[model samples]
Target chain A: MTVPISYYVVLSGLIFLIGLVGVLTRRNIIIILLSIELMLNATNINFVAFSAYLGNLSGQVFVFFALTVAAAEVAVGLAIIIALYRHTPSINVDDFRLLKW
Target chain B: MDSLIFFYFAGIILVTATLVVALRNPIYSALSLLVMFFHVAGLYVTLHAEFLAAIQIIVYAGAILVLYLFVVMLLNVKREERIHRQSLVAVLLGATLLTEAALLVFQSKGPVFPDATSSGSAGEVTGNTESIGQVLYSTYLFPFEVASLILLVAMVGAVILSKKGLLDQKS
Candidate 1:
């Protein structure tokens, strides 16, 4: 028999949790972005898994849209990081405290 | 046999995902993410989404990751400090969420749909790529167009945001 859907869910959940922890606890902006990517990939896994199990193409279609969104997000995010670095010459989140109270 | 292959891919995906977060160097983190991407593609193939598996490699490993590396090298970011000050709280929150998710997943009887391999009906007769392309182009045309628009906006935004002296000149 094929692998159960629960197994995929569990795997996706663990990956998502790891990504969340990375986002919350990491200090570097680049690493933070990478963590965000992790989170995106986790969701993608879940989507594809459900799509295959359900015999539906909609889920895969959604994943395609999600990928497009993810690409855009990375482009804009890295650009923002570059601009921030130009101004302050640092990638550390702690250094960016102007918005923080 | 199927379960064995699934486990192999799952184990590597989990470990490399962790390394992507835990590695000290950004370059190392990106490399681990690259490895993770490949394994994920493998998982996609096992799940019968060959098109997605290919896209996963070409877009994620080939394009997006290279951009990350280019930026990392451009900035020459140094190793970060230990961790965020609120890491203890964050870890606690993550653990709680994990437990809740596990409970929910196990509590359910199982998935409502039939397994992909067992099911041989609509959407299975045609090849994966053909069916996905047909649906994407016809049924999901509107969203597809919107996605292209989003990419255009992001491209313009990135160019404007990263260009030197643009804002200064405007002011």
Candidate 2:
């Protein structure tokens, strides 16, 4: 009943691709941020899978650090989004053409 | 039975992760992300990383998601942008990535599983939590402290970014 490491790798890869697609195609900034979170979680799965199979604690330890960094990223990213929203009153990525000089 | 459980958790994770990306409503997307987070924790449990599973639930599902909800509410932007057609470039890029991943999965050489000794000591340790904690304090103490510092800086940066500015005439 044990699952192989390859299955986890492939699954994480697929999920990562889906997140990439969302980041590439979606126009909403919030959704893009959510997609980024998806990608990070996918990486976490990979980390834990390897940690389990290899009988090491390093992978799980790395995941802990990744989680901490992700939390910080979300806090700062959301704040930037809110500040930008105040200026343009919009969250659409297309509307953020401030650098289109 | 274990394989079935793994599939169940994986299925839920994949589907809800897709929903998190596909759903147009930001609130709905956030909620779906919540589900994905929980299932990811389940997967961690299956992998025998109980502490990571608990942290996944507490940090991601509890704290991070709440932050997302607050942002969604604070912005209060009602009009979701129309879905943009997937451009050809994106499709090409995605397909390439998938192919590469499949190739790596199926075509790689050597043993897929590492030797048990690498992690065998982990079992001799009291539990996964204790094993991880020992390594964290001994070998990884510096990085652990650095991570805390990063969190502190991020908290300050968030406040600076979101706070009402003195430059503006109106509050």
Candidate 3:
């Protein structure tokens, strides 16, 4: 009754692509951050799927580390976004032009 | 039966993920992200990584999504100010990635360890959590500690980055 591994891979791939599209197209920094989370979730699914199919626990362990890092990433990213919004009054990606020289 | 359940969850995940990206309102996008997280957790359950599933629900669905909602509210973004300017480029890049993934999937025979069912040596451990903990605390202990340090640094960095008047006061 187990699902084939290919199905899981395909699903993760599609999700990754969707997230990529969101990251590239969305102007809102917050939405772009959300897209990055989606991409990370897709990766987590891949890790869990491989772990389950291989009967290995290491992949799941890696997932734990990834989740931790993701949380940290979001915290810092949001803080920076808020800071940028405070400075520029906008969260649009194009509005972030301070670095442009 | 299992495949059916997996597809159902995966379908919902994909749909909601799309909604998270496509919706104009950030609040709607956050809500759809919440749905996506739950569906992903369901996928984790199907994978027999129940501990990861629970962690996913707690950390991702509960904490992470709530954080997103809070930011959305705090920012008070009325609506997306403009249409996506790079839609064409995004679609092209996404297509390239999808094609690469498809090729990899079709070319590979199957699971990397075809004969592997379970590592079986973990008999004393009751569940996936115990098995992972065994390795995490032993061989992976250094990296685990390092991860904690990274989190601490990130926390401090975030506070410094977000705090107002501190830099001005110092200067």
- Candidate closer to the true structure by lDDT (higher is better), 1 or 3: 1
For candidate 2, what is the DockQ-based docking class? medium
Off by over 4 Å in 3: B81-112, B115-127, B166-171
Estimate TM-scores for all models: 0.92, 0.91, 0.89
Q: Which ten residues in a row have the lowest lDDT in candidate 1 chain B?
A: B118-127
Candidate 2: give the TM-score of chain A.
Answer: 0.97
Candidate 3 lDDT, tens digit per residue, A2-100? 677778888898898889878877889999999999999999999988777666677888899999999999989998888777777787888777679
lDDT of 1 by residue, A1-101 (tens): 37898789889988998898788778899999999999999999999888888778888889889999999999999999998887778999889886787
Off by over 4 Å in 2: B83-86, B96-104, B109-111, B115-119, B123-127, B166-171
Listed in order, the DockQ scores are 0.69, 0.67, 0.61
CAPRI verdict on model 3? medium
lDDT of 3 at B164: 90
Which candidate achieves the best DockQ against the true structure?
1
Best by lDDT: 1
> Over the stretch A23-95, how does candidate 2's per-residue lDDT look in tens digits?
9888889989999999999999999888787767888889999999999999999999988887778999889
**What lDDT tens digits, residue by residue, belong to model 3 across residues B1-171?**
987899899999999999988998989999999989988988888777888889999999888889888998999977456565666785688679778867876887646656334555542232267778897898789989989998998899889988996434543
Between 1 and 2, whose DockQ is larger?
Answer: 1
Top candidate (TM-score)? 1
